[model samples]
Target: MASNSYCESCSEEGKPIAAIRFCSDCEERLCKEKNRNDNINESEKLESAVYEEVKNWKNHIIKQINTVVEKLEIDLSNCKKKNLDQVRKDNAKISELYDSVKEKEQELKFLKEHGSNNQLYLKLRKQRKGIKDVVKRVSEMTMSYKRTLLKFEKKAEIDLNSMGSIFEVKEACDIQYKPVKLQQAQVQLVRVESLLTLKKVKTNQLNLSDRLCLSDIAVTADNTLCLCNYDYGVCEIYVYRTYLDDLTYSSTLHLPSEPYGISILTGTDKAVVTLPHKSYVQFINTEHLKLDKTIRVGEGWYGITTTGDYIVVSNTKEIRILKKMGEILGTLQ
Candidate 1:
């Protein structure tokens, strides 16, 4: 085993070796063989076995992978179908809402185009006026008809009285019969109901010749009329005794610049009057017709009215509400 030289065929000690493997041509282990032989058949068998085992392993893995992929694909398809169905339902709901909105819009347009409450009120007012006019005309015609019937009845009564006074007289006889003298025809129309007939009185008996030029008359809840007169820079407030009925010119008290617009305080004898040039509303007592208080209004005051506690006045382009003592509370356009 420790020799430097060794046999080539058997690996003997102290011998020269010639061949390390069998020669291909001689089918023997040799370094100098000249013949050749093929060993491809044996290598092909080993390769075929290795390839078959690898093929079997690859087929098994492929079958398992295909099964997993099919399951995933089915899940994906179901998710897509659910999403599509949800989208379809949403679209249907949107379409229905759009149709409902369109219907409401059409109804509103029809009402705006053809029907207006203001126009309806105007039409109703016109119809009411027509009905009132017809009623008044019929009343007048009925009164005339009743008057005509009364006149006919009176003429018939006069004719009956004249017939009772008439008697046939002989035209020619030895003793002549006296002829009655014909009296003048007299007639009177007697009313069927004395109380229902209206009595006509002559208004000339009052002899009302003095012209009353009263403005800004303040009346109480009981219809007592009062006003101020501005003559020659003097102011005098007057109260009519007999309800200003073409017979009275008396007054209780008076105050200054002849206040312009007057309004009765609700449920009281107090009143508010606007002095436009002075830009103030003055509260006056209806019983005494004297100034009780004065309150400043806005600029360019023109008209006035009272709502119980507050006095309302129309300024230039707005309405102003104030307390009774002339404090500005609110303004409205």
Candidate 2:
């Protein structure tokens, strides 16, 4: 026979009723009426707390969106003002050029009409030369201004008229709670395969008239290889073009200091070469194969590599991080 349990709270109130459920935490049996009231209070408190959290979350997201919109609006206004100023300046230049051209035309007309005088022949020659010079100057100026206008047209133009697209708000879906389903199933194992096939390719032996001791090598995306040759007399970097089965020498760039480690900057026709026992790194424009800029990064920099907009240099005891412009950001010892 099953035993019937009486409610502890009801028993204390001098009215013992049958308990429907048992609470492990409370170590007591609860009747239906008392359990219903406790559940209702807990649910209300939970709903209130969740509502407050969601409200705060929505406010934070709205504030961030508003900040972004304000920043974009300010940028747009500044860009519009600058564009208008540039247009005004360009118009003024055009007007000045037009006036000068008109003046030159008048002078030429007057000189042609008064060319019959022998005493005025020398003055006519001088005025004709002046007119020729002015015409040439005006033509050059017009071409330059046209190029400037073309560049402006090619640049990005922001439209601030359709601000409703940026500021429009929408209602979000309500939060939901759902029970997750779990299932027992057998696991399957599959064999892995290799994607790469290694084979012997082409190799070239460099035969230059000048004796060279190769220090470091860097290759571009297009298979163009740059080799740093540390010679006793002159330090030079040789660029080579690699084909399917052969390599050919393209050009050479001479460096003042001894070139040590070299790395090609991705997506650009530039390479950063490190000079050992020196305080500067050379930025070579590989398009022309000449030194473009030199950035002083301190002494004892050997290995060099590019990471985004910054360069990493390694030495014996420390590693230095620097901007492309040569400013040292930090050092790890």
Which candidate number would show the highest TM-score if scored against the true structure? Answer: 2
List where candidate 1 sits over 4 angstroms from the true fold.
1-214, 228-234, 243-247
Query: Candidate 2: lDDT of 120?
Result: 58
Measured against the true structure, the TM-scores of the candidates, in listed sequence, are 0.33, 0.42
The C-alpha stretches of model 2 lying farther than 4 A from their native spots are 1-190, 195-197
lDDT of 2 by residue, 66-140 (tens): 997798778777777877788788888779877877886676577668765663576567668767877787788
The lDDT for every candidate, in the order shown, is: 0.57, 0.74
Query: Candidate 1, residue 31: CA error in Å?
Result: 99
Q: How does residue 259 of candidate 1 score in lDDT? A: 54
Write one digit per residue (lDDT tens) for candidate 1, span 1-333: 222122234444433554323322323332322111123554577578767876776677678768867977787777678767766766675576556556655655665679797765665565566557655755664464321111112234323222122233445321212222210111122324447667654342322224333556666776666664434344445666444345355554555565556789998878777665575667777776567877766445757778868888885688877777777798899
In candidate 1, which residue pairs get closer than 3 Å at backbone N, Cα or C atoms, i.e. clash?
8-17, 22-29, 23-28, 25-35, 25-36, 237-254, 238-251, 239-251, 295-326
Q: Model 2: clashing residue pairs?
A: none
